[model samples]
Target: MNERMTKQPKAIQAIIFDLDGVLTDTAWYHYRAWKALADELAVPFTEQDNEQLKGVDRLNSLRWIAQKGGLALSTAEEARLMAQKNAHYLELIQHMSPADLYPGVQPLFAAIKAKGWKIGLASASKNAAFVLDRLGIAGDFNYVADANQVQNSKPDPEVFLLAASGLGVAPAHCIGVEDAVAGIEAICAAGMRPVGIGEPARLVQASLVVPQIAALSIAQLQALA
Candidate 1:
C-alpha cells in the first residue's frame, strides 16, 4: 500500500470497476482481434505490442499499430480500419457467458451489494455494455461510464470521475478497482482509493494490491477508507 500524507476519506460509499481484466478476461479476445488485423496488414505485432494497448481506445490503439508498422493513412482509412478491428473483436467475444467472468467476481459482487455500496463501471471499451450483457452481469452495476461517454482515456481520470459522478458519490468516497497501471493512475487522479488486482511490483502506488479479485474482501477494502 502507498503511504498517504493527506487525510483519506472516511467511508467507501461506492466502488468503481474497470470491466476488462478486472471483471472478465476479455483481453485475450482483444489481443487476438488486434493480432489478426496486424497480420492482415503485415505488421509485426506481438503480444508485447498488445501490452501498450491496455486501457487505450480503439482508434488510438490502431494508430499505435500503424506507427509501429510505419504505415500512414487518411482519416477515412483510419475509420474503416478501426471498424474492421472492432468487428473482429466483437466476433471473438460473441460467445462469452457468465462462466467467462473472472474468478471471485460473482462473490465479490454479492458481497458489495450486500454491504449496500453502490457499484459503478468505468471502462475505456465502447463495447462495455455489450460485453457485460453477454457475461450476464449488466444489471449488477448501478451506473456505467463507457468509452462512448468520455473523450479522454485512462490515466486522464475522465472515465473514473464520470463513474463516480454517475453513482452520485464524491470521488473521495469511492474505491476504484483496476488491473492495469493506467487505471490505478486514473483512480488516484480521480481522488479515489485504488485497489489493484495484479502484481504488487507493478501496482505499488495503489492503496491495496491483491493477486486476484477473489483475494479482495469488504473488510480489506473498508480498511483503506
Candidate 2:
C-alpha cells in the first residue's frame, strides 16, 4: 500500500499494533513450534536463536529454522515443514483466551479510544483475525491488515502502510507499536512513529521504547506526537 501522505500530517490520530509479540505472547507459541521442528532436525535451538524469527513470515521462519541445522530444503520439503510447524502452532494457540492477551492491552485500547485515536493491527500472521477473535478484541481494532493482503512483510512497510490506509489516517499521524526491530523499521519506513515494546537496547530505533505494553503510558504516547 502507498504511504505517501498528500495532506499535511497531524498529531497521533491512530495506533497500529503488531500481533504476536505486541498484543500477545504468541511469539512463545511460535518459538515452541519452531523448537519442535529444530529438535526433530537435531538443530540446536534456544530462545535467543528464536529471536531472529520475530516479525518474519512463515516461510522465512522456516528458512531460519532449517538454516540452523545447515539443511537445504526443496520446494516440496519446505512447504511440508512449514505446514507442520503451522499445525503445531495452531494446536498450541488453541487454548488462548483473553487472559492470554498481554497486560494493558484492554486498557491501552480504551485509552487510545478516549484520545479519539483509531486503532488497527498490522500483524504478519495470516491468523491475525483468528487471534484477535480468540482474544475477544476483534471489534476493538478499526482495521486489521491481513498478512495475506500485503505483498511484502515487516521491514518492507507494505502492511503498516495498509493499516494506515484502512484507518483513513496518514502514516505520519500514527504510532506503530511493535516488539521487533523489523516491525519498528516497517513503521519508520511507513512514516509512522514507532513505540517499541521491548528492551531499549533491542529497539533503540523507536521513537519511544517501553519494557512492555503496560509500561507504555498515554503520557508517553502523547509525547510521540
Best by TM-score: 1
Model 1, which residues run further than 4 Å from truth?
Answer: 1-9
lDDT at 222 for candidate 2?
Answer: 89
Instruction: Flag clash pairs in model 2.
Output: none
1-225 per-residue lDDT for model 1 (tens digits): 455645555788999999888989888899999999999889998888887788888888998999999999789999998999899999999999999988898898999999899999999999999999999999999999999999998889999999999999999889999988999999999999999999999988798999888899989988987
Please write out the lDDT profile of model 2 over residues 7-101, one tens digit for every residue.
43468899999998888888788889999998988999999988998899998888888887899999999989989998998999899999998
- Candidate 2 ranges beyond 4 A from true positions: 1-9
Worst 10 residues of 1 by lDDT: 1-10
- lDDT over C-alpha atoms for residue 46 of model 2: 94
Cα lDDT computed for each candidate against the true fold? 0.91, 0.90
